[model samples]
Target: MKRLIAWISDLRLAIGLLILIAIASGLGTLVPQQESAELYHRVYDAQPWLGLLNGNAILRLQLDHVYSSSWFLGLLAWLGLSLILCSWRRQWPALQAALRWIDYSSPRQLSKLNLAETLSCSDASQELQRLEDLLSQRGWQVQPHPDRLAARRGASGRVGPLLVHAGLVVLMVGAAWGALAGQRLERFLAPGNELELVNRRGETQLTVALEGFGIERDPAGRPEQFRSQLRLQPGDPNAAVPLPASTETISVNHPLRFQGMTVYQADWALAAIQVQLGQSPILELPLQSFPQLGDQVWGIVLPTRPDGSNPVLLALSSEQGPVTAYSAEAEILGTLVPGGGPAEIAGIPLRIAGVVPASGLLLKRDPGVPLVYAGFAIALAGGALSLIATRQLWAIAEPKQHKLHVAGLCNRNLAAFSRELPALLTELQQG
Candidate 1:
């Protein structure tokens, strides 16, 4: 058990685990995740990298969902365990040692230090007292004994490592908790539509209304960003509403955080086309993607006759204007704008009412988000505090020899500590 504990708490083992976790995270970034099996097979199997890595290997390794993979989560868990053990076995004892004072008795003991010196003194006791007062003035914790004195500065550096370990462990636990119980849902909604938010009991607890959506475009007619206008209301509108409904707009990178859930505008799509034929009522025709023509090109088919004999395709690259009409032979007949002049299609006047756009909203709920934030704050604070150099000083006075022996060392920045030691001896001599 002792050996196992030692092995788990080994510093090298912890470092190795960190390196492995970093490499795995890098790989996860390089690989696309949560894609369909068909997409993976069609892409990876068509052109296998290195002639060995195919879709089969990717699926076998569970790289499609790297973060949720058993091996990846296991690595995080192992690293968290290592941090806990290291703090318990190594960092705690180191902190305790830093808090204690070590008295130097003889010249031999002072000579063993990296920085040691001897100074002539008339009254050793008076010099020791003055030195202790000087150290206290310099913000060092000074403890004077009958024959010796010790001073410590920046001892808080010792606690930094323990705080860092605790923060990391909390972070890992929070991540694991989020992964186990969090929820992510993506839904496309058009204006006047609503998405139902369900609870664990399969009851509708809330309703997210798609009030409106708009796409902001540059002067060149290219989309710069898209926003979704939404409202949150009670699932049953007739019930006495506890939460007030308010309209909000959310765009890419600017999400709406409300009631423990976050809503983001993720994507946009052309849902349908509204048209009117002569004296008939306005009709909405569903649009389909045309990847062969170009990206973001959507088209709809409408039959000229009542029996749906000959179909004419109306394709549009964007929602603004200029919808191109294509005949049965896939030849462009004419181009027209929505809500503009009527177009003659097979001798029947046709007018385009408008194009309907749908907004893709992504909602996420993570209970451990606050815990993760706290962990990050603690980790960053600890990392900054650890940079403080911990310095220790020891001195012993010999009235018979009329010499004061001083020694000091620093956990970091030893050269600066060495220079300070000489300056300290000079001050004692002057005193």
Candidate 2:
């Protein structure tokens, strides 16, 4: 049992676990996570990732969702175990030892320390008292004994490593908790469309509407950013308190945070086309993706003749118009811009009214996010606290020999502390 504990608390084991977690996290970043199986097949089936991982292999190994994978969670658990063991076995004991004062009784005992000094004094007892009083004034916690005195400063530094381990454990636990119970939903909705949100029990909790969407473009007509305006309202019919409706805008990195959920604007797509044929009512045709033509191309078929013969394929890539019409022979019949004049395709007047676009929003809710944030704050504070130098001072008064012995130790910055030791002795004698 002792050997097993020693191995678990080993520094090298902890470092190895950290490295593994980092590598796994990097792999997760490289792979697109939580995508549809069709996407995985399309992307990884033909050209396997890393020349080894095919879609089948990825799905089987749960690589498609690495952060939430069992193996990844196990790695986090193992790391947390190492941190807990190291803290319990080593850091806690060291902190306890630092907090406890130890007395040194003689000059020979004082000389055993790294930095020590002995000075002749007219009144050794008075000097010892003065030294204790001065150390207390200098923010040292002094403990006086019959023949010796021990004091410590920056004892809080000993707690830093323990806090670091605790913080890391909390971080891993929070991440694991989020992976196990967090919720995520991705939706592509046209403007003025609403998406329903549900809780863990699958009851409706809220409704979010895509009130507006716009794309900022460069002078060269390339989209720079996609922005979506959203309106949120409570949807539960059995709720006691009425939740007020709220409106907000979200973009790629700027997400809307509300009631423990975050809504991100992820992607944009051409949804539909509005067109008028002769004196017919304006027909809004839903667009279908034409991946063979281009990544962003969408198409809809329109009858050009009264007999429903010689149908025209209307395709558009963007909302900033110029839709192309293709005949059955795969020849371009005409190009009509939105709000432009009617185009004669097979002798039928067709005019493009407008384009409808959809915004892809990804919503997520994680209860562990607050815990993760707290762990981050704790780790940061621990890192800063670890830099403080823990210094210990010991003194002994020998009235018979008319001598005062002083010894000091600092956990870090020994060279500077060594230089300061002699000055500290001088102050002790002068006092």
- Model 1 is weakest, by summed lDDT over 10 consecutive residues, at 234-243
- lDDT (Cα atoms) of all candidates against the true structure: 0.86, 0.88
Candidate 1, residues 238-268: lDDT per residue as tens digits? Answer: 4775766888889999999987889988889
- Clash counts for all predictions: 0, 0
RMSD of each: 2.6, 2.4
Question: Candidate 2 on 1-431: residue-level lDDT in tens?
Answer: 99998898899999998999899999899989999999888889999999998999999989899999999999888888889998999999999998888777768888989998888988888888888898889898998997679998998988899888888888888898888989999988999899888766898889999999998889988889999989999766687877789889999899988888888889888888999988889988899899888888999987766788889899888888789999998999999999888988778888998999999899988888988988888887888889899999998989999988899999999998898778877776665
State residue 305's C-alpha deviation in candidate 2, in Å: 5.6
Error of 1 at 185 (Å): 0.4
After superposition, the stretches of candidate 1 with alpha carbons farther than 4 Å from their true spots are 1-4, 35-60, 234-242, 345-348
TM-score of 1: 0.91
